[model samples]
Target: MVDTNETHVIVGAGLAGAKAAETLRSEGFTGRVILLGDEREKPYERPGLSKKFLTGAEERDALRVHDPSWYTAHEVELHLGQPVTALDREAKEVRLGDGTAIRYQKLLLATGSSPRPLRVPGADLAGVHYLRRLPHAERLRAVLRNLGRENGQLLIVGAGWIGLEVAAAARGYGAEVTVVEPQPTPLYGVLGPELGGFFADLHRDRGVSFQLGASITEVVGQDGMVLAALTDTGEELPAHAMLIGIGAAPDTALAEAAGLEIAPREEGGGVAVDASLRTADPDVFAAGDLASAYHPVFGRRLRVEHWANALNGGPAAARAMLGREVVYDRLPYFFSDQYDLGMEYSGYAAPGEYAQVVIRGDAGKREFIAFWLDGENRVLAGMNVNVWDVTDPIQRLVRSRRPVDPERLADPGVPLDALPG
Candidate 1:
C-alpha cells in the first residue's frame, strides 16, 4: 500500500518520465506525482520528430504522449519548461531552473539526451539544423517546404538512423541530398558492412548520393547562411542547408553534480544503475537514455538510446522505486523507416561481439531476417528488414540462448518456429 501523502518526483517529461508517472498511478500510488520538463510543451512521442511529423503526415498534438486533460485528471503536476538545475541529495530535493526547490520521497532521473553539437567552424550559421526535438523537426519541415523540389541541396552529416531518415524526407521534397559518413558504410558498426551496404544501395536507388568514409572538416557559409560543406579529402559539397546527425550525449549534469556514480564512456556513459535501476542512493533511480543499466542477459551494462528502452525501462524503474522485486532484462529493440525500407531490430550486440551473421532471405531483395550468432551458434541478436511477423520467433531464438545449426536457421523451408530452441 502506498502512503498517499508521500511525493514521487520525475525529472524529464519525455516518454520515460511520462511512462513512469503513469505507472506510479496504475501501481496504486496516490502520492503526489510531479513530472518536470525543460520544454514548454507537454510530453510527446519523439519518434515522429524524424518520421510522420517531419513529413507533415501527422499533426503536432498527435505526437503528445498524453493529452493535457489526462495529466489534469490524473493529478500529475505539470512542471513544463522548468528544468531541474540541481539535485540536493542531502535535502532530498531538486532545484529547478526558476530556483524553486521541491522535496521528494522518491526521485527518478529520466533526463534524456541532446544532440551532440558539431564543433566545426560555421556550425552556428543559419540553414543548419539538428533533428532531436519537436521544434527542430518543425523548423526543418518549414525549410523543406520553402526550399521546394529540386530547388536546393541538403547535406546530411552522419549515416545513422536519423541521418538516413532525414535524407529520405529531404529527397521526397525534391531536394538534392548527399550524406557524409565517416564510416565505410551506413550503419556499418551495428548492422555490419554487408547489411549496411544494402541500405547504402537502397538510398542510391532512390537518387540519394553518399560520401562514405568521409568527414566534414568545416561548414562554409556566406553572410551567416550555409553555402557548402568542405570534407577532409578537399572535396566541397554544395548545400543550401545542412543537418548534423552524429549522435547524442546524455544529459547528466544534474546527476553528476549530485555525486551519482556514472558508467565509463566505453560502457555508454550515463548514471550507473544496477539491474533494478537503483542508483547508489536507494531513494533515487535512473532510467531511459540517461541510465546505464546492467543487463542480465548481456552480462554487462548498457545504455540504449532507442524508444523501446524508455518504454520498458521507465515502468521497470517505477516498480523498483516502490520496493518491488523487478529486473530490467528486456531485449533492446528499435525500428526505422526510410522510403520503402522498413526494419525492426531486437536484442543487442556491439559489432564484432558476435561471430557470424546468418541470413534467412535475400538481402539483395531487402526482404530478410538476419541473425547474429556467437561462436557457439547461439543467437545474440536478430533483425528483420522489409519482413513482417517474425519478430516473436527471432526474439525467442535470442532469449533461449541455445545453439542451433546455422543451415537450418538460414533455410526458409525450416520455418523460424521450427528452429531448435
Candidate 2:
C-alpha cells in the first residue's frame, strides 16, 4: 500500500536495500517504503554463498537477510523478482521492467553488482558456474552435495575470495580441485604480494593444487556439460564442473541513465559518492558496493563489497536521504571463515603508501596484525587476521591518528598502543 505523499523508493533488494528500509522504520519514517530487487527470491545473505551455503553446511534459512513475514510487518511494498529498468530523474519516477511507473520523494540506488563473467570461450557451458545469488549457490551446492550427478574434477577459474572459498568447500567434499590463476599470486592486485603469497601457502597446505601464470584458452564441452578446459600452455585438463570467481562489476546502468555522476576507481567502474553518501545529484543518494564512498582515514575513495559496508552504509545513506546530517565513516570491517581460521579487517593498506607496517605476531602460523602508516607516516589502515582480541587498541590508534616508535612496533613485549595510527 503506497500512499501518495508517504512514498520512498529503494532499488535493489540485497543487503543495502533491506537495511535502508529497516533503518527508515527505526528512524520513525512511517512513510510508504518500496523495496525492489531483480532477483526472483526474497532477500538473503550473500557472504555464505561461497562457503557454508556452497558446501551444504548451512541451509537456506541461514542465508536469508529477512524472513518472508518480516517485510509485511514493516509495511514495506517489496517488489521481488521485478527489476527497475530506468530512472527518470527529472520526473522523479522509476520505470519498472513491466512498464509500471513508481514515484518517490527519495530514491536510493542500491543496485549492487553482478558477477564478472569469464571471458574465455565456452563460458556458458552447463557446468561453468558463477556464485552471486542463492540460485547460483544452490546449483554449485548440488554438485558438491551429490557427486553422483557430476564426475571427474573441479576446475576453478580465478583465485579470488570466492574462488578460494569455493575451492576449500569443494575439496572438503572430496573432489579433486585445481585452481587456475593468471597472476603470480592471488589477490595481489588488492592485498599485495606478501599477503597474496601467504594465502597461496595456506591453500597449498590444505591439499589444493594451483596453476599460477596460466591462462585458459577455452572451455570445451559436449551437450552442455564441460569436458575440458584448455590452457595457453597447450595442456587440457578434464573438468566435470567449473566455477568462475573473477570479480564483480557495479550495476550502474540505471544510475548512468538517471544522469548521476559516478566516481571511477583506479582499477575501474564504480560510481562516486560524497562523505555523506549523496551523489552529485542532491536528490539521489547511493551506498554499498555500487558507490565509491570517500574514506577520511585513507584520504581516497573506498568501495567495499563486504557485508559490513552493505549493511551499515545503507542507514548512513538513509539518514542523509532524509536531510539529516550523519557521517558514514566507520572504519571498514569484513570477515571470512576459511577452514578453521577467522580472517578480519578494519582498514585499508595501500601497497606502497605505508611508511611502516606493524606485524604483531608471526605470519606463518596465523595470529598476526598488519598495520599501515600514511605518508605523513600516521596510521591509515589495520589488517588484522587471527587476532583473538586486539581491535580495541587498533581502533584507538585509528582515532588518535598517530605514529608509534619503530622499535616498539616490532617488539612483542610492548603494547601496540606504543605505536601510532
Best by lDDT: 1
CA error at residue 385 for candidate 1, angstroms: 1.0
On residues 111-174, what C-alpha lDDT tens digit does candidate 2 reach at each position? 8989888887898899898889998888988886555344348899888888889888887787
lDDT of 1 by residue, 1-421 (tens): 3455799999999999999999999897888999999998899888889988887889899998888899989889989999899999999999998899999999999998999998898899999899988899999998877665547888999999999999888877887889999999999867887678888999999989999888998998889999999998889999999989999999999999999999999778999999999999999999999999999988899999999999889999999988899999999899998888899999986777888989989888889999999999999999999999988999899889999999999998998999876
Our tally of clashes for model 1 stands at 1
Task: Report the C-alpha displacement of residue 310, candidate 2, in angstroms.
Answer: 0.5
Instruction: Report the Cα lDDT for residue 112, model 2.
Output: 91
Off by over 4 Å in 1: 1-4
For candidate 1, the C-alpha RMSD (Å) to the true structure equals 1.4
Candidate 2 local lDDT, residue 94: 95
After superposing candidate 2 on the true structure, give the runs of residues whose Cα lies further than 4 Å from its correct spot: 1-3, 147-151, 355-357, 374-377
True-structure lDDT of candidate 2: 0.81
TM-score of each: 0.98, 0.94
